[model samples]
Target: MPYRILKRKDLIPGQTILMVVDAPMIASKSRPGNFVILRVSDKGERIPLTIADADAAAGTITIVFLVVGKTTAHLATLREGEDILDVCGPLGRPTHIEKSGPVICVGGGTGIAAMHHIAKGHHQAGNRVVAVIGARNKDLLLFCDELGSFCPEVLIATDDGSRGHKGFVTELLKSRLEEDKEIAEVVAVGPVPMMEAVAKVTLPFGVKTTVSLNSIMVDGIGMCGACRCTVGGKVRFACVDGPEFDGHAVDFQELKMRLGQFRTEEKISLEKFRGQS
Candidate 1:
């Protein structure tokens, strides 16, 4: 059966949206890091989204996404009561939660939605949760208050100084780490460059860090081999093995190159989509 969108709203006008889907099976089983693969229509490409929240008792899964690409721009046009042709999940491995001390959850851009779940999970697991979220400007920012609800301390950063600290999110993380915060573990989700920067900053501090990778994924399962990446000298699939991995062991440089391989095709696809829209 198709998953219906019970509710939908713009978190950032024309840019990002929060969608509540009627997928009880996925909601009941989903964990913090688990994601879902959805198809807008029969011919639309499968778009993978991280589960920002799940209300099992209510039989709904919440997802947040930015309208940056063709598929996402199309998604923004959808309204409440519309149905997603296919939604196959909760897929991938769930995040490993524990009572690790002083957990820092870092997010940039649309990744803040995913980080919200991770930060809350850590807090519930009895860890001191700190959140750092950022965007290009204040209008583009998201989840600051939502994150504050669970995280005891929430920090903000923005590239244009429209709100919060006037710098990259990594700068805030580095400054905080330098202050001798006893951070036991970190969970980050963002653009590849942002995650790479977070990994670089934490590597010197000897802090355990995990980053969720939004690699190219065709199937919600491992059969497509589209979401493969190298971690600690071993090949791993983001769909089945993880959307999360040890930051220190990840080969980020290679991953960065792989993410850009379809730039030309993506641009052409986006242009065609916009024209048809």
Candidate 2:
């Protein structure tokens, strides 16, 4: 069955489509950090997106996306009440949450949507949640106000300091770690480089850190080897094993290269499609 687009918004100048899918059961099972593979048309490219929001009773799930390629650009053309060809799952492992001392949640770019559930979980578990969200600029900062509701303290950072601190989220994390030595766990989700930097900052201090990874995933279910990563010097598949991993142990340099593999092609696709529009 097709999923009806309930609403669409320009979240941080990109596209966020809130679709009411037919899979009521799937919506009920979704958790934070989990994602779904969606196809806009019959021949559309399958894209993996973190489940930003969901309501079981309403049988809806919101997928927030940045139009980065041909598929996403096509998806952006969709309007409310339009139907999508396919949307599968509630996939990937959810972020682990516990009342494990003070939790500082960091999110950047579109990763803030993924971090939303983790922050919500931490807050519900009675942990003191500090959400440090950053974007390139004020316009890039999405969900700042929504995420702030779950966090006791919400720190915003931007490269130009348009709306928050005048530095990267990693810089904010460093200052906070120095000021308060009680942040037991840190969850950083964003671009690979940002997550890597956060991992580096927390490594020496022995601060337990975890990161949400978006490795190359095809099926989003374990059938494909695309989402593979090395952890503890062993191979791990991100789809089945985790979209989350210990930041300190992850080989971020390798991950960075893997993500960069399609940069040239992706840029061309985005440019071509943007030109057509």
Candidate 3:
């Protein structure tokens, strides 16, 4: 069935778009770390996006995505009241949240939106949630207001010193870990490099760290093997085993190599698409 877009907003005008889609079943079933595979048109390739938020009572699931390729560019053109050709989800394993202690969630770029849901889950589970989010500048930051609503501490890092700390999110996280000895876990969702940095920062602290993988996916199920990655010296599928895994155990080098395998083709496709448009 086609999913209707109930609302749409440009979180970073022309670069990032947020959409609230009407998908009651998915919304009700969705939990932290779950994602959806959507198609803008019948001929379009399916792309997986993490669910930024879900309101079961409202039957809506929010998705935030960066317009990095042809598919996302097309999706950005859609306005409120339009319909998505297909949206199959609440896929992947939900985050493992339990009342342990303070949990720090680190996010960069568009991943801040995805981290919002997980941080909210931790908050609802009675865990003290500390959100550390980063962007190039204050204008590029996202979900600060929403995260601030529930989180007791919302720390920020901007590369250009536009606001908050004038450094990387890792710097804030490292300092926080040093000051808070009782922190139970650290979760990161963002670019591969950022997640890698988070894992490194949390390593010496002995805090359990989780990182969400945004692997390239074809089918939203394990059958495709397209989202396969090595975690803890074993092969696992991001779509089924987890989109969230032990950060220290993941093979970042392999994941980074795989993510870039199609960069050339993706660029060509986006260029041809733009030419047509």
Candidate 4:
């Protein structure tokens, strides 16, 4: 039997699917920051999405996804009780959280789903977690209240100042750092550009920073090498090596280029899909 959808939500205009599958192994073993590869049907393309929430007792995992492509949009059309043809593990390396000091978690756009798990983990680790979320505007921002509940502080920012801060999330982090000296580490999950901005802000301060890369992933296993990323002049695969890495060591320029390699195709596909709808 395939994985069945237990629930589905349009969280902030994006598709959020909560699926219940027979993978007791995955739910029992999943830790925060781990992701899974899913296929809607045998002919569907593989896409990677982070686990927003999980309940091991019930053997369920919640995956919140932003419908950004043909596959994702197709996935959003699925309804509760429908089954995903293929659902693979508990993939990617989990982030290590500890009560080291004040931790700031930053998320942008659809990255909130990924950040929520980390924020929860940090809070459980007894770290004072400050969650900062941003989007182009209010509509694109999701999981603010949910993430806020797990963090010591929650800051919202938009490019247009529609919600909280007028500037970017990095600006908010910068101001917080200026006002307080206790920030020990920063974990960011979002678009490559946003993570790069936050990394630049934290680099000079010597604050330990980590970022989760969501570059296109095919096989969740490292064999495909599709999710390859460069860090400290060494190439690594995001799937097996890490979806998380030291922010300071990541070559953002190269990552940005790689992420944009299919921009035109993606845009055309999005446009064609939107036109169909």
Against the true structure, candidate 2 reaches a TM-score of: 0.93
Question: In model 2, which runs have C-alpha deviations exceeding 4 angstroms?
Answer: 14-23, 264-277
TM-score of each: 0.97, 0.93, 0.99, 0.92
Candidate 3 lDDT by residue in tens digits, 105-144:
9999999999999999999999999999999999999999
Q: Indicate the TM-score of model 1.
A: 0.97
Question: Each candidate: what lDDT?
Answer: 0.90, 0.84, 0.96, 0.85
- Model 2: per-residue lDDT, tens digit, 160-238? 9898799899999999999989888999989998999999999877899999988987888888788889887878888
Task: Please provide, for model 1 over 113-183, each residue's C-alpha lDDT reduced to its tens digit, 9 standing for 90 to 100.
Answer: 99898888888899998899889998888888888877878899999998889999989899889885688
Report the poorest 10 consecutive residues by lDDT, candidate 3: 219-228
By lDDT, the better pick of 3 and 4 is 3
Model 4: residue 96 alpha-carbon error in angstroms: 1.1
Best by TM-score: 3
lDDT at position 157, candidate 1: 92
For residues 223-275, write the lDDT of model 4, one tens digit per residue.
Answer: 98788899999999999989999999998888877878988988887788779
Better of 1 and 4 by TM-score: 1
Stretches off by above 4 angstroms in model 1 are: none
Query: Candidate 1 at residue 13, lDDT?
Result: 86
